[model samples]
Target: MNPPNDPRTAADDDAALRALYGRAQAQISAGTTARLHRARHAATTGSTASPARRSWAWPAAAGFAALFALAIGMQSLAPPAPPTATPAPVLAEADGAAALDDGVADALATYEESPDFYLWLAANESTLLAME
Candidate 1:
């Protein structure tokens, strides 16, 4: 290995690398060289896309823009949708014993069905109070 601080060694190394690169470059096939040249030219000229492909870009962009505009226009021109109708809340009757709402009637029916639970609680009331 060349010394890191030696300028002569660095120069010699650079020259050797350049010579190696040149020989390898010279060994490349003509077809490969032509392809490399074309690639370099295309990169430098900034024309990687074919003319046919590039031709469709503007039209495609315009078509998308037109579609977006049509969608927005249709949304604006169309009538506003009618507000959704919700069921009116059940109100209590003026008289105390009149017809009850379905929810209240169902709760009353459930309590009536579970009379055994109420009876058990009544029997255990004194014992539960004593334990507490």
Candidate 2:
């Protein structure tokens, strides 16, 4: 006698359930494939963004060279001015003042010996005194 609830009948009606399960599995696999593709793309882009080991030295050297050149250019463009030195003292002859005094004495003697010197001096003496 056939069983009251045979598994075969349930399985015969299970086509719809099987189709649903297959669709869910397919969606999960598609999502996983898309995620894997995105992960691979991200890895590739990350590697490209990083500097290569072989070419690493060039960037560092270029940076140092640029800094060195800038330092040299600034130093050459605005060099420090030279320090100023104190000026030397001027020297005068020891007899210079004595010579000037003798010349003045001779002029006074000559002016006194002139005949009209007193009359001229008297006329201008008040003006000369006023100046004094």
lDDT of each: 0.86, 0.82
Please provide the root mean square deviation of candidate 2 (C-alpha atoms, Å).
28.3
lDDT of 2 at 12: 68
- Least accurate 10 contiguous residues by lDDT in model 1: 91-100
**Model 2 agreement with the true structure over 42-78: per-residue lDDT tens digits:** 7987754345666979889999999999999999999
The C-alpha stretches of model 1 lying farther than 4 A from their native spots are: 1-19, 45-51, 92-132
Tens digits of per-residue lDDT for model 1, 1-132: 767999999898899999999999999999999999998999999987367868888999999999999999999999999999987655543344344466689888888899887998888997899999
Q: How good is model 2 by TM-score?
A: 0.25
Which TM-score value belongs to model 1? Answer: 0.47
**Number of the predicted model whose TM-score against the real structure is largest:** 1
Clashes (candidate 1): 0
Q: Give the candidate number with the greatest lDDT.
A: 1
Clashes of each: 0, 0
